[model samples]
Target: MQLLRSLLADRDWSQDAVLLSRLQQALLLLRDPAASLDEATWLLVADETAHYLDFRRLRTLEAQLRGCTQDEVRYTRADWQAARTAEAALASHLRHVRFSSYAPEPVPMFRIH
Candidate 1:
């Protein structure tokens, strides 16, 4: 998450590379041919796809602004905000998933006794 924040702030090429590097194994798993994940796992991945594409587009925008100006690009503040919002949403979901894993399911009152 920090990496992504730094990326949005600095638009450094290395940050983007680092982000991909950190996610390399997951990416490979996600892209594996003839691979099947359980429904829960696929649901998790499905949730991420939108944010992933949002940042993909944001990354393109970041690439354009990196170390030079690309006037031909039509990027604007509203577009940038949309990307940031998506990233934030993804981060929130990740945090929720991370912590929720540690939470125990509540026992039914009938079963508690």
Candidate 2:
């Protein structure tokens, strides 16, 4: 994954956090009665993309199951659970690592010359 490699090399924590939160929200929406199956599937794909961006392997086997068939792409309950677990763990780890690295120092205020 070029995306993951780029994200890791660039280390843009704010962008990563925003994307992660959006992925989390998408996951929640996937569980809602009003959400379409297609929407849920797209959310899962988005979740996978976010995970890839974070350089994390998708915890769910569903990530592997994706694109297996043309008609059906929905993840099983177990798959969703695995995805959630992976997302939570990766998000937590990223938050801890990214935020902690900057906590000790104040950002420099620049005066344009």
Candidate 3:
């Protein structure tokens, strides 16, 4: 992460020209603005670019995360309900945990003379 950040920090991606071009294209494709794109370029976005991605995890959610949307990320009513429930559960758990069998032994206070 540090290395990648360092590399990208300068914003000089000339070292990896191909990756820079593809990333730029992907960003533009995502925007899909009013500007018209060439047919070949438009078709190219459909074909997966090398070193680019298709994240499967975003589509799949574990049983615990049942409230999340499947297709795209959007906060739903279920998500709010789940969040409130989790927050309440966490508070309850913390309260229970606070009442230990006995208080921990106290350490000597630092003396600064």
Candidate 4:
């Protein structure tokens, strides 16, 4: 998950549909370690055209993931080490991912008095 962490750490990272989707998956997995990647993918693709949604989207996502939970697996130290190694390896080949035509959500500008 170093790749996910790296993407999240980069302030310049564009919060595009793809990025947001990845974030959602990462968050879901973090919140429920028993959740499988397939479950995350399914929820993200359930509404193919919906790249952005309000917080209510979580409710929708949760509904979709309701049946996909697995019994929590305990992670051994070796498993954690392997995961870290994999993340480090993946981070090496990573490139900045961005959407070509994505227009960011508008932010209100404030002028200092």
**Could you give candidate 3's per-residue lDDT for residues 1-113 as a string of tens digits?**
23333323332212356754654554555566765556766455433231111222222342227665544455333443465577689999888878753577788899989
Ranking by lDDT: 1, 2, 4, 3
**Which is the winner by lDDT between candidate 2 and candidate 3?**
2
Q: Best by TM-score, which number?
A: 1
Cα error of candidate 2 at position 61, Å: 11
RMSD of each: 15.3, 17.1, 16.1, 21.6
Residue 59 displacement in candidate 4 (angstroms): 37
lDDT of 1 by residue, 1-113 (tens): 33333333433222245544544434455566776566755564454454544555775767676744433355544566677988889999999998787668998778555
The true-versus-predicted C-alpha distance at residue 107 of model 4, in Å, is 64
lDDT of predicted model 1: 0.55
The lDDT of model 3 is 0.45
What lDDT does each candidate get? 0.55, 0.52, 0.45, 0.48
Over 1-113, each residue of candidate 2 has an lDDT whose tens digit, in order, gives 34433433332222446665655455555567796546655765566667453333332344455745412444333554566787889999999998688456876898998
Better of 2 and 4 by lDDT: 2
Task: Please list the residue runs of candidate 3 whose C-alpha ends up more than 4 Å from where it truly belongs after superposition.
Answer: 1-72, 101-113
| Candidate 2 whole-model C-alpha lDDT, 0 to 1 | 0.52
- Candidate 2 at residue 62, lDDT? 42
Off by over 4 Å in 2: 1-67, 70-74, 102-113
What lDDT does candidate 3 reach at residue 39?
72
| TM-scores for every candidate against the unseen true structure | 0.31, 0.29, 0.25, 0.27
Cα lDDT tens digits, model 4, 40-64, are: 4656544322422221233344445
Error of 4 at 80 (Å): 32
Question: Could you give me the TM-score of model 4 versus the true structure?
Answer: 0.27
